[model samples]
Target: MALLITDECINCDVCEPACPNEAISEGDDIYVIDPDLCTECVGHFDEPQCVVICPVDCIPHDPNHVETESDLMSKYKRITGK
Candidate 1:
């Protein structure tokens, strides 16, 4: 599944650099996770890097974009050649 940033974000800019997929980006006032790029760190890390580095716990799974591990793995492979 993709990760979405909630309004509770503290805007500390911590999660931005943590995303291995380069999915997270700074929005107008908070950070936003691009669904197209967010793979929940499936192919890169055992855990989601943004969720770990977020200070306010603003990151949450995007139910609208439910995806299986295999789907994410496919996406990761397509994006990074891994």
Candidate 2:
């Protein structure tokens, strides 16, 4: 499943660069994740870089955008052409 930045985000700017898929970006009030491009790092790493690097632990799975591991892998392939 894609990850979402919660309101707890401090806008620390660490997550944007950590994302291999470039799924994170600066929003008006906080960083936002592009669910279409987010694969939870399935193709890039064993864990989501943003979640691992987050200082405030604001990154979490989006329940509204629920997806299985297979689904995440598919998204990763589509994003990376791998």
lDDT of 1 at 71: 93
Supply candidate 1's per-residue lDDT for 47.
95
Residues 4-63, model 1: lDDT tens digits: 999998888888889999999989988899998999999889999999887777788999
Off by over 4 Å in 2: none
lDDT (CA) per prediction: 0.91, 0.94
How well does each candidate superpose onto the true structure, as a TM-score?
0.95, 0.97
lDDT winner: 2
TM-score of 1: 0.95
Alpha carbon lDDT of residue 59, candidate 1? 88
Give lDDT: candidate 1, residue 75: 92
The positional error of residue 37 in candidate 1, measured at the CA in angstroms, is 0.4
- Report the Cα lDDT for residue 19, model 2: 96
